[model samples]
Structures are given as C-alpha cells and as structure tokens.
Target chain A: MNTYIEGILILAGINLMAVLGLSLLTGFTGLFSFGHAGFMAIGGYTSAMLTVKFHWPFIPALLVGGLVAALFSAIIGKVTLNLKGDYFCIATLGFGEAIRLILDNVQYFGGARGWPGIPNYTNLWNVLGINLVAVLVLANLIRSRHGRNMIAIREEELASQIVGINVFKHKITSLMISASYAGIAGGLMAHYMTFLQPKMFSLVKSTELTIIVIFGGLGSISGSVLGALVLTALPEVLRSFSQWRLVCYGLAVIIIMISRPEGLLGGYELTPSSMKKLYNRLRLKKQAGKQGLEGGDIQ
Target chain B: MNILELSGLTKKFGGLTAVGNVDFKVKKDSITGLIGPNGAGKTTIFNLITGVYKVSEGKVIFCNKNITNKEPYQIAEIGITRTFQNIRLFKRLSVYENVLIACHKNASYSILDSILMMPKYKREEKQLKLQANELLEIMGLSDRRELIANNLPYGLQRRLEIARALALKPQLLLLDEPAAGMNPDETEQLMLLIDDVRKKFQLTVLIIEHHMDLVMGICEEIMVLNFGCKLAEGTPYDIQNNPKVIEAYLGVEG
Candidate 1:
C-alpha cells in the first residue's frame, strides 16, 4: 500500500482506540464526555517524556501514559460524576479546556512552542495489534456482569440502584477506563506524528471523538469501529475538494443523522448470530413472496 | 418476630411533611399492606426505607439493625430491595437481561477476570445465566426472554420488575403498587404470584397497593396511612370494621 493510505489507516486505528473507550462511556454507560482529548494530552506528554527524557521502552511508556490519564480521570470523575445529566457534560467541557490551557504554560515539554524529535515508533502493525487487544478487552467487558451493570445504570439509574448497583462507583469506573483508552491513543499519535503541541489536544479534538461515537451508534462496539474507520478517512478521501472538503464532511454527517437518528447500527451488534438471524428472516420473506406469486397465477 | 420497625419516622420537604411521625412493625415473613388515598405518603415511606430520601427524624430498624439514612444501593445490598411505583425495568434490554443485571451482585469476579475471560469468570457467568433463566421461568417470562422489556404488556412489565427485584435475593421486598395498571384478571394472577413468591423465597414483604380486593386477599396484616400518619393497623377483618378507616376511605357521614 502507498504511504499515504498507510498513514490514514494508522490514524484511523488510533482514533478507533479512543472511540472504543468513549463508546463504553457514552453508548453503554449513558455518560457524555467532551474532555477525552485532555486524557490524550496527558498520555502523549507522559509517554513522550519517558521515552525522550529517560530512554524508556515504547510499550511500557505507553502503558504508563494510560495509567496517568486514568489517575487524572479518577480525580475529575470523583468531583464531577455526581452531577447528573448535562451537568457532567459541561464539567468535562470545562476540564478539557482547562487541561489545554494548563499545558500551554508548562515549559518543561516545550510549552506553546510544541515538542519535536519524538521517535516514530507508532507503526501500522503496532497500531493494529494494540487496537485488536483493545477491542477484545472491550467486547469481553461489555458482555460481563460489570458491563451489564453499566448498561443498567444507563437505562435506568434509580432502578439500577434499587437493584443493588452502586451507580456512582460504576460511573467513575467507566470514566477512568475511557480516559485510559484516550491516553493510549494519544501516546500512539505523539509517536506517529513525531511531534506534540498543546493546541493539538484542543476542545475540537474532543468534540471530534464524541461525534465519531454518536455517528457510529450508541451501545455497539462494531459500530464504533466502522465509524472510526469511515469518519477518519472521509476527510482525506475528500482532499481533492480542497477547502470545501470540510463542508462536504459536515454535510455527510448531517445527512446520516437525519436519515438514521438511532445511528448506523443503532444498538444492534454485528455478530455472527445476528447476521444469521437477518439472513433467515430475508430468506423467509423471499419464500413468502414466491408463494404469493404462485397463488396469483392460480387465481 | 418483627422483620422491620419504623419509630417516629418523618420526612419533611421544606415545610411540607410527606411522612410524619409514622410508626409500624412488619412481622417476619408476613405480607404487610400499606394503603391509603393518593398523596397519603405510601410511596414516600418506601422511598425513605430504601434510602432514596433521608429521614427527617426517625429510626428504621430492619432485622434489629438501624439502617436509617443509608444509601439506596447500601440498603439493597443489606438484603432490602424494592420495585418502583412506576414499572422501572431496564426498558431497552431484553427480559432475560433485565433480570440478569440484577443478578450481578451475586458474582464477585473482578473486571480483569471478565476482560481476560478467566476460568472463574466463565464459571460464575454460567451460574448467573442459569439463575437468570430460572427467575424468568418462575415469572412466566421464559418464552419472551428475548423480547425487549418496554415491548412487554403493562402487566408483564410489572411482573418483570418483581422478578428483577427477586434476582437480588433480598430478604425484605418492598413493592409499590404492583397492580396499578393491571386489570381484574391480571390482578388476580398477580395476587397469586405474589403469594407464591413470598412462600417460595421465604420473603418478608411490605406492599403498597390501591386495589382493595388484592390487598385484602393476600395481606396477613395491613397498615393504613392517612395524611402521613398511621390511621390504623390490623388484620383484614379488623381493618374492615374500623370506623376511622371507613371514614378515611369513604368520607364521614354528612
């Protein structure tokens, strides 16, 4: 494959990692966050510092980056996850902007000037491998009792509590796991681009991640993966349109939202069993149509 | 032995008292009914007992333990679970999943165990599935296991809520109007089902109901609340004969 296509694929993989985490939070848990880019920033800077300043290995640094992001999310989640509904969304918006502005003044990692000379360790193979593990782990977690509790909390929080689920604890847990994913994604992006800037992890980046999740469909991992791949490549595919590419991208998103409000897959999964069920239903419909035609001929 | 005791229980919202200085004792393994007109604070009492609202001034003693002002989940964890006045099944989930989510507390496998698909996770999960299926079977929802909860008939939705509560293996079950939207035939079935559940689970039930026939049929003891105060408490016969209870239900003679 050409380097251009390979680069886009790698970018899509990184975005998929973050979208999977956000999918767990927004889709399954019913919590909306607009501060995930801040997590990416923390991970990016932490991992970059480890590799550049201390000469640490790539994978361990990435894991440490995710851990740091999870730590920060735990603190923020404790303070704001108690706020119900849109209040939590607003809190995360403030948090994302705050992280960016704080990073702007920190001179240790090149501050507003941006950091360069980061090793190019984020190859397509590593990205693919990491994303595979992420997806499997996420799929397993969603199918478990813990995942069911999160979905229960999302569906009806009061009922979940009445059913013996500790809602607050589960909310924080979702937030922390989500942040860790964003953190790892950020580390990958930093190494891939071989550069970092506070501005790169702005509110827009966070909004983009959220949009990808919603566009994919809530409560479906496969939808997030498809969404990440399609959405990340759309702009690059439209590059020939020049400055109008973004306008075209915005139009495409609006069209999808209007046409399918529940999202591309809604809450349905694309597993083998579901596919088989769909196929059987279609075959039965076809058989019924044939029977109707035969009855018409007899008439 | 009494399974639950409320002494001087009161809940004041600003100056408006929802449940005021009410006291009652629920005998162990007995189906106790709480009934009154609308706004009589029956649901408020359920909320207070479940820790949805903090008590203004009262003591809620369950099994000789003072559990007043605990979190709702904590109250549930301590073997007290409730069904809402409004049927609050996880609406988008399937019938089996609705009950299975409640069965979560029974399994103690960690998140790591689940994500990594450990042997312990598989073993516990298999057990939870069996338990969920059994509960669904008992609730008569086995055939509709894959149906979304919101799509179930109103009466079955109510039944599903009770089944979900039972999944917690709660010692004391507080049911808020399990027969609200149910028809006469459905109500009759519900009465039998509630009685059967109580016997099978060896549960102590405190129920709030507006249906006199169902309440009178299954409840061994009844507590009447009028404007947040205890109006009367006794057997069905005693409560039917009480003049004050009659006056409260049907206005005093003009």
Candidate 2:
C-alpha cells in the first residue's frame, strides 16, 4: 500500500484501539468518560521517555505505558466512579483537562513547548498486530461472566447488585482496561508522529473518540471497528475540501445521528451467527412471497 | 427456627419515617406474607433487609448472622437475594443471559481465565450455563430463552426476575409484588409457582403483596404494616379477624 493510505490506516488502527476501550466503558458498562485522552497522554509521554531516555525496546515501553495509564485510571475511578450519571461525565471531563494542564506545567517532558526527536517505531504491520490482539482480548472479555456483569450494570445497576454483582469493582475494572487501551493507542501515536504535545491529547480528541463510538453503535465491537475506520478516514478524505472539511464532517455526523439514532449497527453484532440468522430470515420471506404469488394465481 | 429477623428496624428519610421500629421474624422454610396499604413501608423493609438502605436503628439477622447495613451484593452473597417491585430484569439481554448473569456468583473463574478461555473458565462457564438453563426450565421460560427480556409479557418478566434471583442460589428470597400486573388467572399460577419454587429450592420466602386472595391462600403467617409500624402478625385467620388490622386496611367506619 502507498504511504498515504498506510498512514491513514495506522491512524485508524490507533483510534480503534482507544475506541474499543471506550466502548467497553460506555457501551457495555454504561459509564461515559471524557478523560481517556488524558490516559493516552500519560501512555505517550511514558513510552516516549522510555525509548528516548532509557533506550527501552518499543513493545515493552508500550506495555509499560498502558500499565501506567491503567494505574491512573484506577485511582481516578476510585474517586469518581461513585458519582452517578452526568456527574461522572463531568468528573471525567475535569480529569482529562487536569491531565493536560499538569502536563503543560511539567518541563522534563518538554512541557508546553512539546517533545520532539521521538523514534518512529509505529508501522502498519505493528499497528495491525497490536489492534488484532486488542480486539481478541476485548472480545474474550466481553463474552465472559465479568463481561455480563458489566452489561448488567449498564442495563440496571441496582438490579446487578441484587443479582450479586460487585458494581463498583466492575466499574473500576472496566475503566482500568479502557484506560490501558487508550494508553497503548497513545504510545503508538507518539512513535508514529515522532513528536508529542499536550495539545494533541486535548478534550477535542477525547470527544472525537466518543463520537466515533456513538457513530458505530453502542455495544457492538464490529460497529466500533467500522466506526473508528470510517470516522478517522472521513476527515482525511475530506481534506481536499480544505477549510470546509470540518463543516461537512459535522453535517455528516448530524445527518447520521438524525437518521440512525441507535447508530449504524444499533447494538447488533456482525458475527457469523447473526449474519446467518439474517440470511435465513430473508430466505424465509422470499419463500412466503412465492407462496403468496401461487395463491394469487389460484384466485 | 427463624431464618431471618429484623428487630427495631427504623429508617428515617429526614423527618419522615418510612419504617419505624418495625420488628419481624421470617420462619425457616416458610412462606410468610408482608401485606399493607400503599406506602406502608413493605418495600422499604425489603430494602433494609437486602442492604439497599442503611438502617437508622436496629439489626437485621439472617441465618443467625447480623447482616445490618451490609452492601447489597454482600447481602446476596450471604444467601439472600430479592426481586424488585418494578421488575428489574436486564431488559436488553435475552432470558438465558438474564439468568446466566446471576449464576456468575457460582463461578469462581478469574478475569484472566475468562479472557484466555482456560480450562477452569470453560468448565465453570459450562456448569453455569447448565444451571441457568435448569433454572429457566423450572420457571417455565425454557421456550423463550432466546427472547429479549423487555419483549416478554409482564407476567413472564416477573417470572424472569424470580428466576434470575434464584440463580444466586439464595436460602431466602424476598419477592416484591411478584403478581403486580398479572390477571387473576396469572396470579393463581404465580401462587402455585411460588409454592413449587419454595419446595424445590428449599427456600424461605418473605413476600409483599396487595392481592388478598393470593396472600390468604398461600401464606402460613402474615405480617401487617400500617404507617411503618407492625399492626399485626399471625396466621391468615388471626390477621383477618384482628380489628386493628381491619381498621388499618379499611379505616375506622369512615
């Protein structure tokens, strides 16, 4: 593939990594977060420091970055996960902004001036490999008992508790896993761009991730994959329109939201079984139509 | 012997007392009825026993353990589970999944085991699935196992809630209005189902109901609550004849 297409694909892969985590938190666990970009920033700076200052290997550094993000998320979740509904959303927004401002003041990582000379380790193949692993791990987690508990919490938190689910612990677990994904995504982006800036992990980036999750459909991994790909590529595809690009992007999002409010997939998975079910239903409809035609001829 | 006891249990929301010094005992393996008028704090009492609300005063002892003010999940873990008056089934999930989720307590596989699909995870999951299916079968929901919970009829939804609660394998089941939206025929079926479940599961049940016929038909002992206080506690005949209970329900001769 050409470099331009490869670059976009790599970018889409990174977005997918973050979007998948957010999907688990928001879609399955029913907790909305705006601080995920903060997690990415932590991962990006941590991994970049490891590579640039300590001469660590790329993969290990990325894993450490994810771990650090998970740690931060655990602490944040401990404090804010108790807040209900919109209050929790606001807390996460505050957290994301707080991380950005803290990074702005920290001079060791180049502070407000931004960090440069980061080695480029992110490639299409590695991005693909990491994302493949991410998807597998997520899919496995979602199918497990733990995953059901998270979904239960999402569906009815009080009922989940009544059914013996530890709601607080599950929420924290979801947040930690989600943050680590964001952290890994951040590490990848740092290496790909070979530069870092606190501004790159701003609230807009967080909102963009959330918008993609909503666009894809809540509670569907395949939807998240399609969403991250389409949404990440849509802006780049609109680049030829220059200054009008954002306007068109916003308009397209609004149109999709209005027409398909439940989202593109609407919590439906695109698995083989579901696809087979759809095919069978369509065939049955065709058979019914043929019977109706035969009856009409008799009449 | 009593399976559960609430002594001087009082819950105050600011100046208002939802349940005031209400004391009761649920006998082991017995179907006890908690009957009262609206806002008479029957559900509030269930909430207190299940640890949904912090007790302002007094103790909740279950199976000879003081379980007052524990977390709801902890209450469930210690062999107590409940259904909501409003039927709080996981609406978007299928009937099988609704029960399966509750059966999670019986499985001890770690998150790592689940993600890696280890032998322990597979074994536990298979067992849990069997348990869920068995519970569904008992609840007469086997045929509709794949249907979304929200799509089920109101009566079935209540049954699903009970099945989900039973999946926890609790010794004591607190049911909040199990026959609320059911017709008389459905309510009759529900009464029999409740009796069957109690016998099969070896359970102690504390039920809150407004349906006089069902309560009178099924309850061995009935506790009446009026303005958050225990007005009467006796067999069905005694509760029916008690003038105080009568006045509490029908009010003093206009």
Candidate 3:
C-alpha cells in the first residue's frame, strides 16, 4: 500500500475511534460537548509522558491515557452536566480552552513549544485493531438495557425520570466513555506523529469531531465510521482546488445538511437486516395500494 | 391501609399556588380519582405526589415512608410511576422499545455486564423482552409492537403510555388525564381497563380526569379540587349530591 494512503487510513481510523465515542454522547445520549479535544490532549500528553519519561509499553500507556481522560471527564461532568442546553455547551468549550492553556504553561511537558521523542507505536494495523474493539463494544452497549435508558433520556428527560432512569448518572457514564475514546485516539495520534503539541488538540479539533458525528447520522455506529472516513479524506481529495478547498468543503457540508438534515443515515443502521426491513416495508405499502385499487374496481 | 398519604400538600409556583394545603389518602388496591375544572391544579397535585414539584408545605408519605423532597427518579424507584397528561412516549422508537426502556427499572445487570454481553446481561435482557411483550399484550398493543410510537393513533398512544408506566411495576400508579381526547366509547373502555388493571396488577391507582362518567363509574373514592383547594371528598354518589361539589361545577346563581 502507498505510504500516503496508509497515513490517511490511519488518520481516518483515529478519527473514527473518537467519532464512535462522540456518537454515544451526542447521538444516542443527546448530550453535546465541545471539550472532547481537551480529553484527547490529556490522553496524548499523559501517554506520551509515560512512553518518553517512564518508558512504558505502548498499549499500557494508551490504556493509562484513556483512564486519565475518563477520570477527568467524570469530574467535569459532575460540575457541568447539571447545566442544561447551551450553557452546558459553553462550559465544555471553556473546558477545552482551559486544558490547552494549562498545558501551555506546564514546562515539564515542553509547554507551548510542543513535546517530541514519542514512540511511533500507532501503525495502521493497531489503529484498525483498536477501532474494531471500539465499534464492537459500542454496538453491544447499544443493544443492552443501560443503552436504552440513555436513549430514553435523549428522547424525553422528564418521561425518562418518570420511568425510573437516573438521567444524571447516565449522562456522566456517556461523558466518561466518550472522553476515554477521545483519549485513546489522542494517544494514537501522538504515537503516529512522534510528537505532541497542545495546539494540535484545539477547539477546532473538537468541533471537527462533532461535525463528523452529526454528518454521519447521530444514532448509528456505521454512520460514524462512514462519516469519519469520508470527512477525514475529503480535504485531501479536494486538494486539487488548492485555496478553494476549504470553501468547497464548507459548501458540501451545508448542502448535505440542507438536503438530508438527519445526516447520511438519519438514525438508521446500515445492516443487512435493516435493508431487508426497508424493502419489505416498501413492498407491503405497494401491495396495500394495489389492494385498494382492486377493491375500487369491484365497487 | 392507605398506600399513599398526603398531609397539607402544597405547591406554589412563585406567586400562584398550584396546590394549596390539602390532605388525601389512597387505600391499597383501590382506584381513586382526582377531578377538577381546568386550572383547578389536579395535575399539580399529581406532580407533587410524583416529585415533579417541590412541596411548599406539608409532607408526602408513601407506604409509611416519608418521601418528601425525593428526586423524581428516586421516587419512581421507590415504587411510584406516572404517565404524563400529554402522552410522553418515546416517539422515535417502536412501541416495544418504549416499553423496554421502561423495563430498565427491573433490569439487574451492571453496566459492565451490558458492555461485555455477559451471561447475566443476556438473561436479564431476555427477561426484559418477555416482560415488555407481556405488558404490550396486556395493553392490547402486541400487534403494533413494531410500529413507531409517534405513528400510533391517539387512544393507543395513551394506552402505550399507561403500559410503559406499568412496566415500572409500581406499587402506586398515577395517571394524568388518561381519558383526555378520547371518544365516549374509548372513555368507557378506559374505565373498564383501569378497573381491570387495578385488579390484575394489584395496583393502587390515582387518576386525574375530566371524564366524569369514567371517574364516577370506576373510582372507589373521589376528590374534587377548586382553585387549588380540595372542595369535596366522598364516594361517587355522595360527591354527586354534595352542594359544594355542585357549586364548584356550576357557578353559584347570580
């Protein structure tokens, strides 16, 4: 495989890991956060520190990074998840910026100058391996009872509470899981680039992740995978336009939103069974119409 | 014995008192009705009972436990569940899924079990599915189990809401305007259904309704509210003959 193609695929895989987690928070649970990039930053820097300073193994360092991100998200969620709607969004935005600024002044991790000498542990195969695990775990989670509680909270908070769901507890659970995913993705990106800089995980990075989640279709894992792959590669594919590339990218996103406001799949899955169900529904509707015509002819 | 006891239960939204200091008791395995004219705070009383509103004064004791100031979900976990007046079904999901979501109250598996698909998860999940289907069948909604909740006709949507509430297996079930927007035939059927479910599930029900015939026909005891205050409490026949109840329903001559 071409190294350029391999790099893009690896980048796509990393983005997919983060997107999958966000899909649970934004898509299934209906909570939006703008500080996921901060989680990734924590994961990348912490894991990078372990590998560089403490000489930890690659996979264990990645796990530790994810754990730290989850812990940080739990604390943040306790404080901010109570804030409803746009206030919560603003709080997360502040969290992302705060993490970046704090890292900027921390001299031990090279601060704003960036950190180097990280191991190149994130290859395409390992990236693919981790993403597979992430998707399976996410898919299974959705199929379980706890997953339904989260979706209930998304649909109607008051109704969910009346049904005995602990909305706050589930929101925190979602934030922690999503943050851990972002953390692992950060760890991968850190190893892949062999360097780290707080600047790399900015508010822009967080927004980009959210855009991918919405563009992919909120409640479906397959949608996230497709969104991550297509969106990550879209800029590279549009490079022929040079200066006009970003302009085209923004226009494309606008067109998609305007045309199919629910995103690519509209909360529907891309499974063989789902496709069959759609086909059957269409056929049944047509049959009903035909029966109506026959009855009209008899009349 | 009284399953739920309310003493001077009051709720004031800023300056407006939605439910004034009032007392009521619902006997176990009985169907009780709370009826009032529009803006009489019947729903507000239900909210106060279900923890949707904080009590401005007095206490709510359920099954001998002082449940005042508990969170809504905590109140639910303590065997209290309710259906909204406006039909708050999970619109985007199927009827079965809506009931299954409510069945989460009975699921015993841990989050880790769910993520890993452990045996305990599978067992509990199978049981939940069975319970949801059984509840749907009981509600006469088994045939429409796969239909999205939003697509259900108005009456069935209301039924689905009740079915979902019952999935919590509550000791006390509160139904807010269950007969709202129903035709006479539907309202009649709901009265019978309420009676049947009360007997079948061994449930204690408190219903807020404007359907006088249904309330009068089914409720073992009735309470009337006027401008956020309880005006009458008695058997259906006694309430019908009560001068104060009649005055509340029909303006005093003048």
Q: How would you encode candidate 3's per-residue C-alpha lDDT over B36-72 as one tens digit per residue?
A: 8999998888888888888899999999999998889
Kindly give the number of clashing pairs for every candidate. Answer: 0, 0, 0
Q: For each candidate, what's the DockQ?
A: 0.91, 0.90, 0.81
| Full ranking by TM-score | 2, 1, 3
Off by over 4 Å in 2: A297-299
Cα lDDT tens digits, model 1, A1-299, are 89999999999999999999999999999999999999999999999999999999999999999999999999999999999999999999999899999999999999999999999999999999999999999999999999999999999999999988999999999999999999999999999999999999999999999989999999999999989999999999999999999999999989999999877876989999999999999999999889989888644
DockQ of 3: 0.81
What clash count does candidate 2 reach?
0
Q: Candidate 1 regions off by >4 Å?
A: A295-299
Question: Candidate 1, B97: how far from true, in Å?
Answer: 0.3
CAPRI category for model 1:
high
**What is candidate 3's lDDT per residue for A248-291, written digit by digit as tens?**
88998889989989998768898899999999999999998899
Chain A in model 1: its TM-score?
A: 0.98
Alpha carbon lDDT at A297, candidate 2: 62
CAPRI classification of candidate 2 = high
Sort by lDDT, best first.
Answer: 1, 2, 3
